[model samples]
Target: MNIATRTLLVATAALTGLAGTALPAASSTTGAPTTASNSCPVKAWGYRGHYMCGTKLKAGYIDWNRDGRTDEVFVIAPNRHIWHTWKNAGGWKEMPGRGRADDMVGDNGTGSRSRCIIVYVIKKGYRYYQNCHYNGRWHNWTTSG
Candidate 1:
């Protein structure tokens, strides 16, 4: 074969080999769910901070470990008091104290008072440490019962 013809054939063969070896660009799409799961509960207190003063400490919801369901309820007092209650327990139970400063204050403005309760639903074996005030007064979030 002539030089020009031979060169053309070689180029064509190279192009064909490249096309056979190459693949089309892959898609960059994902298949993740848009909404959150039902098991994972939402947190009333976004962070580990005190809520607004005199907000009438209410029971807040949280998933804690994010399992998609609210299994735990937390009672948070402005005086840094924390109580962990579960759905199965049927009642509230005080957690061990960490000896931290009070988040709420007393009428005298010197001592602290229990004024809040936050509820959190977390998975089993999930341990959380918090500092809170435990004055003898039982502050209920739902009602004055």
Candidate 2:
């Protein structure tokens, strides 16, 4: 075969191998739970550890905070409990009040997965919050005006 053709084949092979390696990382997002319990079902309101709060939480898309744009939420769960934090137009803020904001129990044979537990706050004019869980911790984010 021509040198150019062989070189093209080698480059294609290298690219194919690289692409294959990346697929696993992409699929890893759907893998097992990192720190939180995979079997915990999210409840609307329940006991999350010592703190009573909301459950079955899911992170929402990023949006404007009164001041301007902000970073996304980040969460971590080491084991039973989840910890959350976020960056806002104002700055970084940890969730207020100590305690679990939400709780979850394993779901029955309904074929549904465990629910997410999260905490949030709403003021007179402001409404709603965003949240996410990653690396064994929970993150809560919101916009304020």
Candidate 1, residue 33: the lDDT equals 13
The C-alpha TM-scores of every prediction are 0.27, 0.22
lDDT of each: 0.32, 0.28
Score residue 40 of candidate 2 by CA lDDT: 35
The TM-score that candidate 1 achieves is 0.27
Model 1 poorest ten-residue lDDT run: 30-39
> What's the lDDT for residue 139 in model 2?
37
Q: Name the runs in model 1 displaced over 4 angstroms.
A: 1-60, 78-80, 98-145
lDDT of 1 by residue, 1-145 (tens): 7899957754554333212222122112211111212112222322222332332233244343447665444543332234345555444443342211112221111123433332221213321222333475443322111
